[model samples]
Target chain A: METKELQEIASLLRFEAVRMVYEGGDGHPGPALSSADIVTALYFDILKIDPANPDWADRDRFILSKGHACPIWYAALNERGYFQPKVEHFHLRQLHSEFQGHPSMKNTRGIDMTTGSLGNGIAIGAGMAIAAKATGKDYYTYVICGDGELQEGLCWEGANMAAGRGLDNLIVFIDKNGYQSYKTVDYTVGRNNPAERFMAFGWDVQEIDGHNFDEIKAAVAAAKQNKGKPSCIVCNCVKGKGVSYMENNNNWHKGVPTKEQFALAARELRGISL
Target chain B: MRAFSGSREAFAAALLDMAEYDERVMVISADSLKAMRAVPFGEQYPNRYVECGIAEQCAVDVAAGMASCGLIPFVGTYCGFLTMRACEQLRTFIGYTHLNAKFVGFNAGLLGGEREGVTHQFYEDIGIVATMPGIQIFTPADPAQCYHAIRMAAEVEGPVYVRAGSGREVSVYGNDAPFATSGITVWKRYGTDALLLSNGFVLDRVLAAAELLSQREIHVTVADINILYGDDASEILREMAAANLVVTVEDHNINGGLGSYISKLACENRPVRVHRIALTSYGESGPANELADAYGFSPEAIAQAVAAARTQQ
Candidate 1:
């Protein structure tokens, strides 16, 4: 797909995520909006998955390790035709909604693994990669982890094991949005260089603008081409990318927006239907 | 249908058979292959076995990962380390998500160690694991039950915690004993003045107590509760209600173990007098038999408890 088309999809995903949060009365829109471009790039272009057959054995696997941002993931899945992309599909965090607060493999059609707790996705992705190797399958496993989620000790365990085993089939993207739950990532957890850490763990590391389609595509291509090591793409991103009022605002991490704020954000994210 | 001399040996043999049956069956252990006696399985299918060096938390998460990919991964380690150290990881990834991960907790209770002390002994494992919803917990009494339990757990969907022993256990039941997917196994029954519920290697002691009680004219029924927390507690409850007193004996802490579980059942359904005989304190380092005797789980101790319960009634 062209850069323009990817960008269009990214905007639509961001819009749908906001609409889900807005309609559902509450959700973590910050991370959801932040992950829009990366999710859009993977679902629309990079990932080798069939919407009709979510359980295709030979298909590439993707795990959302930072699972609270599932609104964007649900949006991507919906637009990809895993389910109908209707306005009613925006009932994200409802009691019986298949689109739960977190990604559940049993509940969602396109989800490969159930992930809600931070730091689990990377290891599970590594497990799938290990399984692929064991079964002699040639499918790549992609995992998107949040910068805040890296604070968990288990992520390092998976990373260490992935590198030790030389899992070239595994590729990870860390959404390096500076804002975390309470404060900025650096202020909350110090300026921990994920790229340097990945490099030290014997992973091929790349730094890129997360919102940029070209960078994401290039980084993914580079990760695929690289062998004998897992790749980590540290995507420097704004917490709320498109919304003017919500950008870099930690308070928007999770909340139901006011009617005025929702209208303003909808106008900003033009061409997105509610 | 073959049985080994010990539960751990039987467990290892069962794992080998399971691996042979299903290519998806994999084993991940925390660098205790020799201790678990899983060296044969590891050596034969090198790719299927993962020796996750002494990291219980990492091993469990790794197993959870393996389970996610349509593979039946059994994680084995010492009971204390596997339950205490990796508890959160187990609860979150395996328990909460309802993953098909099998946990083989070796050497539960005072049977685990001599040199390692309380760190290796886990009388609190059953209590900790029992709280998790939809988790299948089984404490196999002997080698036959252990072999059958492993095969059954592999066949069952969702998380299964099989508590195996390190002690040289006398056979509670022959190979003919029915190993149902869930529920209690009545080994021997007499006049049901008191129902004796026991599990693990400790069932031998409970049976011995029953024999000693009979000599004293205190007839008690002995049953091995292999399935700890299954759907049908109805059978066990009915037996408990029939008896004048219910006595639960386990090689676990009295707080949240089988004793506590039975006591709760008695309070709710039977309203019968319940006596819980289990370890009251952290265990000390000694030989396994000596530890059992010291901790009031010996045949003499159990018989004394039965006599005390008869007096109370």
Candidate 2:
């Protein structure tokens, strides 16, 4: 698909994510909006997935490691026709809801791994990638880790494993959205250069603007072409990328937008006066 | 029967046996390959064997990820580390998802004492894993039974935790021993005066005590309660009910190991005096048998407990 077509779909997914958070009454809309474009770009372009046949043996595996940002993921999966009722009517985090607070591979189709806890995705994705290699299957594993989630020791543990095992089939994208739950990454981890850290671990590094569809496309292409070592594409994104009121605002990390704020967010995403 | 070196060797041999036909079978470790005695598996199928450095959580998550891809991965590590350190990973990813993964916790009971004191001596492993649903635990009698338990873990579908030793376990069952997938297996049945239940490597002591008690005319039906967790063990519960007195012998802690299970069963279902003979505290650096003896896990301790229980009744 063209960049224009992808951007349109991404905007629609962003609106769906914001709406789900507003309706669910509790969710992290900031991180969801921060990761919206990357999520859209992967599902629509980068991933070798079959929404119709989710359990296809050779399909590329994607793990949403920063699982608090699941509204965006639910939006992508729902829009891609993985399951029923669509993103708008979904009962997120409800009793027996497919759209759980964190993504579950068991409850939701198209969810490759269950993640909510910050640091599990990279190791799990590495496992999947190694499994594919062991079985002589041609499939890649892509994992998206939150910038703050990198504080978890398992992320480094997994990064070291991927690099050590020569897991070229694995590609990790760090959603370096500046801000975490309470503050920005700079305020906590000091500069928080995810690309340099992954490179030090011997990974092929590509630092890019996360919201740019073209940059995401190019990094993913470079990552796919790189051999021997695993790749890490640091996606420098805004905490609340598309929403004017939410962008770079740490309060929106888990804050559910009020009626007026939701209207403003809706208008911003839809590019119209709500 | 050919006397195997240790339960750790049986642990490796079983994986070798499974790999003959099942290509999906592989060993994933957190840099404890030698400790697990899985060097042979790694040597045989180097491609399948994965060493995730020293990260226990990564090893388990790798297993969960591999299990999701239809590969049966047996993650091996220290008993205390695997069950405690990567506990959330086990409970959340493997247990909650009900992934087809196997875990062999080496240096169980006091077997790890000689290596490095209390840090390695893990008696709370069974209790920790038992709290999580969808996981079946097996504290096999000895090396032979550990083989059958590890083999059975591969046969079954869901998650299985096989408690093994640091090459210190004595062989209990014969070469042709038939291990039931789940439930208790009676190793010796002299009488029902006092039903003696045991698990893990300490069953050797229980059987010896059973023989000594039999000589003293205090006959008891000795059973190795190897398969600790299953959906139904009513037949064994009925046996426990028939006996006037029940005693559980183990090398693990009395709080949450075999003793606790038998006590809970007798307390809720059938009221009986469940005498527990197991470790009450951690061990210091010593030989496996000396640690076992200090912990009152010797054959004499079992006999003494039985004699005391018999006199009380």
Candidate 3:
């Protein structure tokens, strides 16, 4: 797919995600918006997955380890026809809905694993990669982790194991959206470079602009070309990308925008900033 | 299934059988390959065996990862480390996700103190995992039962936590010991004066105590329960109703174990006096017999508790 096409889909997804947060009256829009572009690239171009037969044994596995940012994931899955739903019409966090506040493998079809709690998806994703090796399957496992999610001790423990095992089949993309749940990742943990840590842990590391479609595609291509070790693409992202007021704003981490604010966010996503 | 010197070896034996029949069955150890007597399994199928090198949380999440795919991974490690250190990891990844995985917790109780010290021993494991839904808690009696329990756990579709003893656990059951995926087992039947309920390797002493009580004319009905939680309440409730009083014996802490579990049931359902004989404090490093004596779980101690149950009622 062309970069322009991917960018258009991503903008649509960002608007849809923000609208879900507004309609649901509760959600983390910051994460959802931040992860939109890369999420779009994976669902639209990168991932080798069959939407009709989601349980295919050889499907490339994708785990949203930073699960709170799942509105973007849901929008992409809905757009890719993983399930029957008009992406703009469905309730976001409704009770018993397939698309819960966070992703649940038991509930959703395209969801490879359940995640809401931080630091779990990466480790679980590593396991899936190891499984690919065990079964001699060509399917790669992609994991999207939050930079703030790195504060969890288990993430490092998992990284060490995956690196030691030389899980070249695994590719981790750190959504470096600066702001975390409470504050900025740099302010909360002191040191901010997730790429350096991944390098120290022996993973093949790369840094890229998360919202850039070309950067995401190139980074993924480089990750696949590289061998013998796992890859970590630290994606520098705005907390709320594309939207005028919400971009780089931490207050949007978990909130529903007003009618006027929501209208403005939607317009900005359509390249009609007014 | 033949009994080995310990429950861990017997469990490993059963794991080997599981792996032989099913190509997807694998072992994930936290640097306890030698401790679990799984060096043989590792040697036989190096591709299937994953040694995470002393990280319990890492091993468990990795096993969850493998389970998410088509593989069934058995994680072998110390009970406390697996239960305490990686409690959240187990609850979220394996428990809430309802993954098809088996956790073989070695050094389950104060009896594990004989191996190392209190650090290796875990008396609070049953209590901890009992709260997590979808996790089947199997506290098998001995090596023979551990063998069957591991086999049964492998058959379970979701998360199953089978607690095993350290390498020195004595085999009380015969080669063909009866094991349940979920239910209680009657180890012996003398009378309904008292129901002797116990789980884990301490069942050896519990059976002996039942024998001594029978000889003393204090006749009690002894039962060994493998499923600590998530059992059909009817059979156990029937056994509880048959007895005048229930005597709980285990090599675990006084709270959150068989004693506490049964007491909760008895208090709510049956009108019977409950007598608990379990570890009162953290485990002490010593010989198994001495630790048993010190913690009030010796054969004589269990028998005396049964005898004294008449006064409590």
**Per-residue C-alpha lDDT of model 3 across residues B4-91, encoded as one tens digit per residue:** 6678888778878778789889999889888898888999999999878778888988998899898999998888898899899899
Q: Provide per-model DockQ scores.
A: 0.55, 0.87, 0.78
Superposition TM-score, candidate 3 onto the true structure: 0.97
Q: In candidate 3, which residue pairs get closer than 3 Å at backbone N, Cα or C atoms, i.e. clash?
A: none
Q: Which residue pairs collide in model 2, if any?
A: none
Task: Point out where model 3 deviates above 4 Å.
Answer: A271-274, B1-3, B267-269
Stretches of model 1 off by over 4 angstroms after superposition? A85-89, A271-274, B1-3, B168-171, B175-178
For model 1, how does the per-residue alpha-carbon lDDT over A64-181 read when each residue is reduced to its tens digit? Answer: 9999999999989988999755435567878988988988877888888788888887777877888888789899999999998889887888888888778899999999998789
Q: Judge the docking of candidate 1 as incorrect, acceptable, medium or high.
A: medium
- CAPRI band of model 3? medium
Error of 2 at B67 (Å): 1.0
| TM-score for each model | 0.95, 0.97, 0.97
Reference contacts preserved by each model: 0.55, 0.82, 0.80
On residues A164-273, what C-alpha lDDT tens digit does candidate 3 reach at each position? 88899999999998889788977998989999999999999999999888899999999999888999999999989888788888998999999989889877887555
- What does the interface RMSD come to for each candidate? 1.7, 0.6, 1.0
Candidate 2, residues B103-196, lDDT tens digits: the string is: 9998887865455888888888998999999998977767777777888899999999988877787777886686755478887889888999
State in Å the error of residue A199, model 1: 1.5
What TM-score applies to chain A of candidate 3? 0.97
Sort every candidate by lDDT, greatest first: 2, 3, 1
